[model samples]
Each structure stands twice: as structure tokens, then as C-alpha cells.
Target: MIRTFFTAVLCGLLFVSCNQQQNTTSEQSATQATEANVYGASFDAENVISVTQLQDAVAATDSVSATVTAEIVESCQSKGCWMDVRLADNSTMKVTFRDYGFFLPVEDLKGKTVVFTGTAKREVISVDDQRHYAEDAGKSAEEIAAITEPREELRFVADGVKLQ
Candidate 1:
């Protein structure tokens, strides 16, 4: 009789432990969902650096991994494939998603704040590409024709983004 009683107690304890574990998992999922408007990949919106800090880092290194908070100066009106953000130096840099894995909503998100995880690098954009981006931004024909010179600028490839 004692052996049967002990067996029953062990089973009850096991059931309770499993039930608690399941509840914890569900709670975590709920928290993540309510955290932010996650896009591309899910990441905790932490360790965020400023766009000014990003400018310094980009100038100092060829590439750096970071999470940055910045305001959108412009976005791709055509496909939301990329965005331009103002940096500390009063210049704008283009930000694209890594591997075309995700895209932002096709709307004018200017002045909206966003936090994203990505890598930044410096590169020289070709004249053709510059014109292409201008076209995507719905520039005037005169503006598109004026993009005759290649420009060097900072660029970012974000694997995850959180539109705040």
C-alpha cells in the first residue's frame, strides 16, 4: 500500500512540473509578441545605439555589427526595399535588408523611429544605382538625370527590424 501511494505522489509531481513548464513557455511567447512590431527576424530591442554613434563606428571601421535607433529620412516608395536615415554628420545613409528576406510597409515612413539589428559598412555607389534609387524614391525626371556621379556613403544591412 505504501509503495502504491509513493508511486502516485511521484506521478502527480511530474504532472504538475510539466504543466508549469508549459505555462512558462506560453507566457514567454505572449511577451515577445507584444514587445514590438517585429520584422525579418525576432530580436529583443536592447543594446540600441544612436545614429550618431553609428556614424562614428562606421568611420572607424570597415564594418561593425550593431543595433541602432534612428529616424527615417526616406524609404523606398516603390517596394520598401530600403530606407535612408539621417546620420550625425547631416548626411543620409541607405539601409537595406539582408538577403531581401523582409521588406517594410510601402508607405512614407519619414520621421518615424526604428530600431534594427544589422551591420554597417562604407561603399561607393555607382551612378546607375544612384539613379535607380532616385527613381525608386519617385524623384523628378530632372533629378534622376542629375545622378551622373558615383558617391561614397555608409550602408547598412539589417537582419531584423522593429518599427517603433
Candidate 2:
């Protein structure tokens, strides 16, 4: 009788343990889903082109809409309103959110690879705008003050962005 009782208890414990593990797995799945999607718009990685391709397209014309994949060189430290991504030729392109629709997390984005769908344009950013961006990035006063010339750069306005 004792042996039967012990076996029943062991089976019961195993069942309970298995049930708990299933719950934990479901919870983890939910958490992963939450983390994977950001800024509402879905990120499609299938059509993403390298920064080099984007640069070539932009150079061929003034602007083009494209899906691009690149490494985040830096992001707006204050609000994540903008980001800079590295290009294949060791250059960087500035990326902005589309229509002020969404923002990225302002922390821990540097050096991360991300895919973005957006329009890329070649723009001349004025010195005042450069200074403003520097301030937003929390640059030192001297760094902010060092801005003197306008920057001719490739700028992207992204409708959607996803960290990879």
C-alpha cells in the first residue's frame, strides 16, 4: 500500500512540474512577441538592401524609397528620434522616423543591426540643425559649439524599424 501511495505521489508531482513548465513556456512566448515588435509597423526583412545599395540608389537620383539594413552607429540620446547607420563604404546615413509616427528606444541601440523601410533623400542639413541634433545627442557644450558647416548627407525617413 505504501509503495502504491509513493508512486501516485511521484506521478502527481511530475504532472504538476510539467504543467508549470508549460505555463512558463507560454509566458516566455508572450514576452518574446512583445519584445520583437516595435513602433507598430511590421518590419519586413525580405526586401531589405544593404546600405551600399541604398547609397548607390540615392546617388543615382535625389531620393528613393527602400528597405535598408545597417548597423546603428548612434541614436538620439534624448528621444531616439533619429539614428545613424553605417554604410558599406565606412560612411554613415542618418535615419529619421516617418511623420513623427514612432520612436525607437533611446537606450542600448548603438552597434545593433536594424532593418528599416523608408524614403531616403540627400539633404543639406544646416548648421543650426546640426547643433540641435548634437544637443539632442547630449554632446558636450564644446562639441555642440563646434558645428559650423552644413552637412550634405543621406537622410532616411523610416515608416518602420526593427532591431535584428
- The prediction achieving the highest TM-score against the true structure is 1
Which portions of model 2 show Cα errors greater than 4 Å?
A: 1-35
Positional deviation of 33 in candidate 2, in angstroms?
Answer: 2.8
Reference-based lDDT, residue 24, model 1 = 100
**Model 2: colliding residue pairs:** none
Per-model TM-score, in order, reads 0.78, 0.77
List where candidate 1 sits over 4 angstroms from the true fold: 1-36
lDDT accuracy of residue 118 in candidate 1:
88
- Per-residue alpha-carbon lDDT of model 2 for 1-164, expressed as tens digits? 99999999999999999999999999978966876755636765687799999988989997899988899988998888999899888788889898778888879688898989989999999999999988988899999989999989889999988887
Name the Cα RMSD for model 2: 8.5
For model 1, residues 125-159, the per-residue Cα lDDT tens digits are 99999999999999999999988899998999999
Instruction: Give residue 16's error in model 1 in angstroms.
Output: 21
Model 2: how far is 125 from its true place, Å? Answer: 0.2
The best candidate by lDDT is: 1
